[model samples]
Target: MCALSSQVRPARSVPGARARPETAHATRALILATFAFTACFYAWSIIGPLSPTLQKHLQLSEFQTAAMVAVPVLLGSILRVPLGILADIYGGRRVFSALMAFSIVPVAALAVWHDALATVIALGLLLGVAGASFAVGVVFVNGWYPPERRGFALGVYGMGMGGTVLAALTAPRIAKPLGLQAPFIVAAGVLVVATVIFASMARDAAKPAPRTGRVSLVAPLAIFRTSARAWALTLFYFLSFGGFVAMFLYLPKLLVGVYGLSKIDAGSRAAGFALLAVLGRPVGGLLADRLDPKHVLRVSFIATGVLAVLLGFSYKHMVPLTAECLTLGVVLGLGTGAVFKLVAQWFPDQVGAVTGVVGAAGGLGGFFPPLVMAMVKSATGSYTIGFLLLAAVAAVALSVVSRVRGDAR
Candidate 1:
């Protein structure tokens, strides 16, 4: 196994040393990438909050609604592999611009054809590309920060995840005034502006682009097959980021069904959940940088497992349910930050390729739980089974983490 021990950072440049220009450039890239990521994610997030309204309008069954909501997540997630590789090869500025430009098509289609489920499903597939922007940002940001500061830098870049908070908070309210089309129109506009600004301003870090004479997409995927560390990170992200996405996307539906909250109320509450996670991500990164990330993982997984079981039982009471959900958000957010820190540490040379594999798993992590929840609901008349299943998975992850060696306690 690759050493999990923390290595010392390279010595800081002397005050008289010429690092200012380089630092400025890295900051510029980091800022722009974070903004563009937030915008792209807003488009990715639109469907989840709106799925209930669409369900009511179309008279669809619960399972169908869940599937509809998950389809974009599934596609967005699966595409991260290639997108990350593309960012690594062609540069993040170019790949991110193209991604945002393409996403506008689907967002605009949703605006014009808001009432048609077929149109939404078809266009939704295209819009999912926006979700792949996470990979692009990870590869881009990793290029800028040195290993010593990368954990915190990535956690800051990760603040872009708050885009889901923006969606959960706003999509429902926007739909209230201007109809279902309004939110999509707004998202399209956001993508347009982000694309223009990022294209004009963004630059890849000074790292040399990987010069594969002929890029074979399949070849990059070999990381997952060959690297034990990559698989471990992939599994952790599947739970951490996956759990976060699943809750952000599905909490509105859950609250509405179990507690009888209005769509707007549930949406606002879910926004709170996402917001806490957003805030916690950086904290996790900071902690990981200070302590061994393996220990951070251990604490996050243990706490997350406990919280998941609590959420399963607490649904009947809003106080405990909301508390558990919110706490779970912070824990999962930390897990996410710490996992990527380990990725950056472990695969310094191949962050993009490794991230593609890990990110796809994270996306799939978000995708499956909704389906599982839907199935559980269909058969058992409650979502408890899904939460308990998550707890069990958390336990499994903890066991994997416990074996991590070389890192000092």
Candidate 2:
């Protein structure tokens, strides 16, 4: 069990306090937290865009490169469980700033010692700290918004994932002028600036209940055991958010290898995918808010499955491939938003711990696909099998969604 501080603040129900002022405070907190998340995601995913360059320089096999790109994601996924709990106990502002500050060291180290494989891998694991920021930010942002507005607010925060797009578009170009190490150096600087701004500007929401005793470490597990819906959400996110992560990290490699495109062009296309997905997230949230989340999810999963099948056929024409990729981006992005809306709806009281567990599942979802893609590509000498697998998973998720009974609202 994790012991919480005995000190508890009163809820904002004072006679003179008004809703307008509280709304303003919540908006400010959301903005700062979203920007902070952007910085963290940029640092967390920096390695993906650099993987092709690193592979060429180090003569790494496909499996080795996939492993290198995946290390941080694995840590990021597992650490979210604890970090989310800490945010729930200590408050998001403090925990989030501390995480950003801690990440600077490893981001800087990766810049200085990127040539050594072992050192790069070690630093990448430490870089996973930045990835854990998502759980913290989710908990933080969820606390500030009312139930009706949470979906949209969380969707906006999810846009910070555009940081991955930023990395994809900029890292290679930055590496060209300043060298391969420059990207990490710049990412560390961004974190430093974000940490200062967030700590200074962000405020935690008032707690609804006073802390009377220690929070059990096993509480999250207990919640998972009791709530079949939580498990369903976990599986759904594993496909949606996980697929998004896998695509972001693996797309550059795929583009470069399959299309014979230059690294710069590949990165640009990958950035497009990231951008479309990032933009689609908020739309998903808005739809979930207005419609049944299950309906939104059904549309998204079906679209994703259909698109994955079309992509599996391996269209060689640039126009068709680009169209398919962009369409998938929209579906996956919407699915990501819809899944979290469900989380916020179903587990409002345990947002922090629930976010941690579900987010971890999403991260783990992202982790395995690259290895599978790499292995399948290695064995079959094509990415067709990988696309087929994505379609299969989407179908399975759709089936699960159909079985679950609940009011989306």
Candidate 3:
């Protein structure tokens, strides 16, 4: 068994040396990277909050609506590996800027052609480029910070996921007056501005070892083969981050369909869930720095599983249902932060490659739950089955955590 006792040691400063420029660079990188990530995420998830509008306009069934919302997640999940490799080679500035630029085309295309269902789906696939930004930002931010501080730094960067909340809250409001297409235009505009700022300001930290040979395409797969810990972390993240993504995307739909909430009200509540998760991430990272990550994860999974069961009861009372959803947000957020802390702890050298594979798993984790929820609703005429499935998955993850040893910090 691989020991998980390895902890990142603090960097020692040279005697009487003040590296003010380096410190400044690290701060600037973290901020810019976070901004870029937020913009990309906003673009990637823009379609989700607008799903009901599209469903009504296109007269789509539940399954078709779910598929439409999920298309960007599919490409986003698969492309992280290559994008991470590219960030490793060309640096995040070029790769992230190019991704933002490319994403603009689809966002614009969707704005103009959304009347056609086929066009909307096709454009959504292209928008997956925006979702792949997570991997690029992960490698970029990880490279900038020291191991001792990486968990917190990455967690702060992860807050960019609040872009989903931003989309959920704002897109519908924007669509109300400007038309359904206006939200895409707004997202594209944000990307344009972020792309410019990122390209102009971002810089890669000096590599510890300079690259000499070409980067192998198969490097991520090779790393995956060698690291049992990577697989473990991947599974944990698949549950943690995946569950968060799935819920973030699906909450608006759930509120609208089950409780008959207005779009604005549902978006506001969903945004609250996302906001708590976003805030919890940095706290989870901070806790991992002080305690065993396994313990943190144990608490997280247990809480998540229990809450999911409560949600499965499908309370008609808005107060109980909303409370359950928000609590899961906190557990999931912390779980996500702890998982990445482990990534940086266990695989510092292969952060880029491992992050790519693991991030892909996280994205894939978000991709399927909406479809499952739709199918469950179609077959059983209720969402109770979907919530039960989430509880079951969380229980299984909790069991896996207990069996895995050597997770001390």
TM-score of each: 0.93, 0.93, 0.92
Least accurate stretch of 10 residues (summed lDDT) in model 2? 1-10
Q: Candidate 2 on 1-409: residue-level lDDT in tens?
A: 0111122123233322221223666777789998999999999999999999999988899999999999999999999999998887777888999999999999999888988789889999999989999999987887767677778889999999999999999999999888988999999999999999998767776543355788665676668877778888988889988999998899889888878988888998999999999999989998998988999899989998998888888545678789999988999999988888998888776777888999999999999999999999999988888999999999999999989877432
Ranking by TM-score: 2, 1, 3
lDDT for each residue of candidate 1 in 1-409, tens digit (9 for 90 to 100): 0121122121122211121232656777789999999998899989999988889977888888888888888888998999988877776778889999999998998888867677777888778899999998997787767787888888988889899999888999999888888999999999999999998877665433347477777777766665666778888999999999998888999999988888889999999999999988888999999999989889999998999888888777999998899999999989988988998887766677788878899999999999899999999998888999999989989998887554322
Evaluate residue 343 in candidate 1 and report its C-alpha lDDT on the 0 to 100 scale.
84
Candidate topping TM-score: 2
- C-alpha lDDT of residue 16 in model 2: 21
Instruction: Give the higher-TM-score candidate: 1 or 2.
Output: 2
Model 1 global lDDT (CA atoms, 0 to 1): 0.84
